[model samples]
Target chain A: MKGNEAIAEAAINAGCLYYFGYPITPQTEISEYMAKRMPKVGGLCLQAESEIAAVNMLLGASASGTRAMTSSSSPGISLKSEGISYLVGSDLPAVVVNVQRGGPGLGGIQPSQADYYQATKAYGHGDMHLIVLAPSTVQEMATLTGEAFDLADIYRTPVIILADGAIGQMMEPVDFSERKPRELPEKTWATCGHRGARKHNIVNSLLMEPEELERSIRDRFERYRKIEENEVMCEKYMTDDADIVVVAFGIAARIAKTAAQIARSRGVKAGVLRPITLWPFPNKEISALADTAKAFLSVELSMGQMVTDVKLACECRRPVDFFGRTGGVIPAPADVAEKLCAMSRELSI
Target chain B: MVGSSKRIIIVAGHFGTGKTNVSVSLALASASRGSVIIDLDTVNPYFRAADSVPELRAAGVRTIIPEYSNTNVDIPTLPPEIASVFFSDETAIFDVGGDDGAAALGVYERDISRVGYEMLYVINMYRLLIADPEDAVAVMREIEGYSRLRFTGIVNNSNLGAETTRETVAASVSYAECVSKLTGLPVVFTSVIGDARAPEGVENVFVMDDHTKKLF
Candidate 1:
């Protein structure tokens, strides 16, 4: 199954109905697929005029207490920055998909992992963070689509499934999760209108009062802290005896896995640290590796988005080195392995 | 409008994707049970699928489109929030607007998951570069690329405008198969001009496709 199709199917199966979007390359299949499939299943699939409108629609659906989502490429998501901020401000539950392409502008259509900064460091206006999930395979696309909805509803914060165009359009065998009937948590905060057994509900992001807004921001940050405590996800490969830890995410991490594997074969003592959840950053796990792992080698599609976070987490216990391919150029496994070996030798010397 | 027991249907598509014709016919098909169409397209400027307003209403198919909507201005105001009402109330036929991809997404994408949304993309192989399997996949990718919302199914609405024929309907089936193969999306239904009335099991499209298929 193509990754985009898997995401669409997962959204529907996870009980997603309202879909709003604009057309851009590498991420259009999800909307195109929904436009046709929603009607039969009794769902709402609309193509909006801009990324702004689409994000607003997702906001509306979430406000009304429905499971909703939108998808876009780098530039488009940048257009949706305000909406993402608003969703975070309001603390609404929804899903967003980014089939990343090369950018800084309307860059080329080839695959690139450039949106790491925008996704992880609160891409929108003001202080906020969205739950960002980085998926590697078509199977993960399907798997994460469902997980995003669950996390969004549970935390009342937007969840993002960040993938590049290649992952989205690429065809691969994937297992579609059975569409289980969703039992949404009680919504005292939802606006389904006042009714029997359901009380009046208000869902808004306007915290105009200075103290009130500060309190709201504080509360939201606290929730993020709790999420980091409970939901930080990462994968480690052959780190037990390794002297250097390679940290990466999304497609970059996948390549790192191969590179680390190759370097290990040649006895360079390289291992991979892949963060499935880009946001929580898995600080504690990396700290544990600080003693054994002589240095941290952070690789990203962008020049230095994740590296800064890695350095912050590792706290200078060991020196951190960086190697990246920007504007969507993906470094091959051999290149990564070679870099890993070189960096390992440099740190040792 | 029917109840929780009644089947709920959504007839949605991008602008100029013939959603009006599709929704009306589907409502007519199930007229025996009470049905209604809720118009949710707030993006287009002049042409909307809204004019069929009275027909669906007159046929006992309730239409819930916002009054004064036109294809000319940017009226982002949607009819007062009635989604929860719709959920608690009756069986409905949701008539969504055509392709202002971004504009059409207003106020509806976030809550559908909790309230429940089975989203489908309206595909007109006639839309530029949308007919080819790879192109169709590309178009879907483009939408996903911009909005960050993935599509779940394909609506094969291939017609040569008003020149639509039975053969064209078959061609649409083939186009749908191509999409299913390339993108792993299924063609849930197909639309053709009203007069050509396709065979049983072939979901009929409400729009008049013969002339526009060539023009568009």
Candidate 2:
């Protein structure tokens, strides 16, 4: 399956019936796949007039306690930010997929990880954080998309599937049959009509009073704290006895994995630490590795957005380095391997 | 070995069905005969034959890509150099876009017909949407509707990427035969990765290297 199509199919398998999206390069396959499959599965796939309208439609679907999602690339994601903020303000559960392309404003159609800051730190306006899941392969694109919906419903917050154009466009073999059914909580707070049984449920984010708004924000953060403590997922490959650990996520991590293998073949103690959840940032795992590892290298498709988070995660206990290629240029594995070997030599370890 | 007698060979299929890989391999295999591969894929921005221009040129196969390919501009404008394929005697292979991408090929339907071209539809039974023979036939008809070109043969390119085995190729032979039977097109060849031989009953095996596999 192509990574974008895998996400769409996995969303359906995870009980996501409503998909609202606008077409954008690198991620357009998600909408295309949904348009073809949704009707057959007795669901709704609406291509809105714009990215903003698509996200607002997702907001409406999610408010009624329906499993819904919306996908776009970087510039389109920017247009959906306002709607995303509203979804968060209403404490809605929905999945937003950003098959990231290049940059600040309609940068390029090629793959990029420049939206790390946008996805993790400031997806929208307000005191809010999204559960960001970064998938490295086409298979994970399926599995993590299923997990993204579950995480959103569990926390009642928007979850971001932070993919890049490479994964989104690449084709691979994926098995969707192994998906286990999830135990999701009932949406008692949903604004779906009640049969004169209880009080009417209102779905609105407009809290007029400052104190009430602060309380609402604080309550959401408490849930975020629980997620942070329990949801920090990272994969440590060959890090058990390594001096230089490379930290990366999404497509960058897959490249780093190959680089680590090459560095190991050349007798360098290189390993990879892949963060699956970009928002939680995998701080504890990196800090744990800092106790033994000599240094850390953050490899990204961006100029170095995740480098800051890696540095802060390690608390400067070890030296952190950055290697990247911006503007949709993917770093080669050999180049990353060379960096790993050089870092090992510099540390004399 | 398939369509070697033809001057113009056009490869079309559903998305992710190994059309570009087949086109590249066919062009490289026929490089000694002097070939030019035209990347007429305007539908997809990534993983196009344009990405393999360096490799294709290195192997002595001339490559013609969209005017704005590999650039920030995502327009689907074909270059005027494409007309040279019709005039030259060199064997031209058009790696057309999958499904609706064939609409780009429709623009040159009259010229291609004038030159007498052979269109080969690539199929992968492992692809979810086109797993069934009926679904494969439906997509085949859709491509035909868009390009206004009749398929001369079928290329069973079914395999799980990076996980394909001899058994996998063998398992897909029945599916390919079903497609061939339904479309009244012969199964020209079966594509296998690396040096793996084609399944027992499959004829004219084409060994392909995944030139479209992105490093990152």
Candidate 3:
């Protein structure tokens, strides 16, 4: 099945009760799947008028303690940022999927990782970080979608599943039956009806006090720090005795894995570090590998967005080079292998 | 004999009915005859004829994509190279978009009718909007009205993805018959994924392993 459709099914299997979305390329299949199945499962799937309205609907649903989600591509996701920030401030747990396509504006409808900075650094105008889960495979797209919901509830923060168009549109064998329902914490603070024993729960993000807002923001940051320490997810391929490491995520990681294998076969000891969580950033793994690896190469579909993060993660101790294709162009495995071979030459020199 | 005699074969259907897959399959099937596939699809960029150019080219089938197909430009410009497909004697396959994509095909309506093209409306009975035969006929009429071409045949690609079985394909025979009856078209073939059993009483089944599909 297509990755977007698999994600929608997995979301339904994970007990998502509401799905509000606006149609956008690469991610429309998710909404289409949800529209067909959500009603059959006694859930609500509404295609909002726009991305802004979709995310706000997700906000309303999440505030009432319902598992809700919204999906869009790069341009649409930008429109939904205000609702995302509001959800973060209100501490509402919801899943927002960004099946990324190219862009600064209304860019082309092709797979791209150009939104890494926008997604990890500033999804909205705020001092906040979302739990960004990047999946490379269609199977991971389904499993991580389920995981996105669990993490969103556990951390009480908005979780973003950052998938590119390649992973969103590709067909692969996915077993939706293998999904296990995650145990969730009770939503005692939810704005469900107040049974007359407690004060009516106000699920608004409008705290007008300076000190109170500062304290609350600090408290949220503390949770973010804990999440960074405990919830960083990544995968390593042949990094143990390597002279070179290639850092990537999502579709680029899939290509980089092949490139690393090709480099290894060609007698260069290369490895791959795939960051599953982008906001938590997989810094410790890269830092530890930087000690042994002679250099690091960051491969992406964007013009060196994640490479900046790789540099910071390695603390500039190791030389970090970048190879990328921007504006909907995907980097080829052979091209990445060529870049890695050049990096090896530079290391020996 | 169905697609062999026809010089220009146009594949169209609702979105997600596997028209691109069928187009690629047809081009590769006729690769020895030097087939050329055009990416006439402008509806969605994710799943289209141009995305599989590398694989199609490797199979010895030439692919002509629209201008800025995979590039970072939203301009759905049809390059002048499209006229080459009409003039060439080699087999041509046009992987068109859904009902909305028919409007793009409207541009070539005069040439298509003059040369007499075959429009294969691929159908998956499990897909939405066209799950019922009456609804399927209605959609075909809508597509015909939009594209200004009548469907020559139907490809009943009734699949539920990985869960598709012999029974699934077998069960869609009546649905295919219903659609054929309403549209006054013949069932060209129903596509089966693997070496699974073909429909019990149906003929002309197209067996596709989908080898062009890859992980990366």
**Model 1 misplacement above 4 A:** A178-184, A195-199, B1-216
Better of 1 and 3 by DockQ: 3
Any runs in candidate 2 off by more than 4 Å, and if so which? B1-3
Ranking by TM-score: 2, 3, 1
In candidate 1 the C-alpha lDDT for residue A168 amounts to 77
Best prediction by lDDT: 2
Model 1's chain A TM-score stands at 0.94
Q: What tens-digit string does per-residue lDDT give for candidate 3 at A1-349? A: 6788878988998889999988988788898788878988999999999999999999999999999999999999999999999999999999999999988898878889999999999998777989999999888999999999999998899999999999998766677766676677999878878779798788878889999999989999999999999989999999999899999999999999899899988888889999999989999999999889999999999989999999999999999999999888778898898888888887782
lDDT of each: 0.72, 0.92, 0.87
Model 2, residue pairs in steric clash:
none
* Models ranked on DockQ: 2, 3, 1
TM-score of 2: 0.98
TM-score of chain A of each: 0.94, 0.98, 0.98
C-alpha lDDT of residue B103 in model 2: 95
The number of the candidate with the highest DockQ is 2
Residue A293 of model 2 has an lDDT of 95
TM-score of each: 0.62, 0.98, 0.83
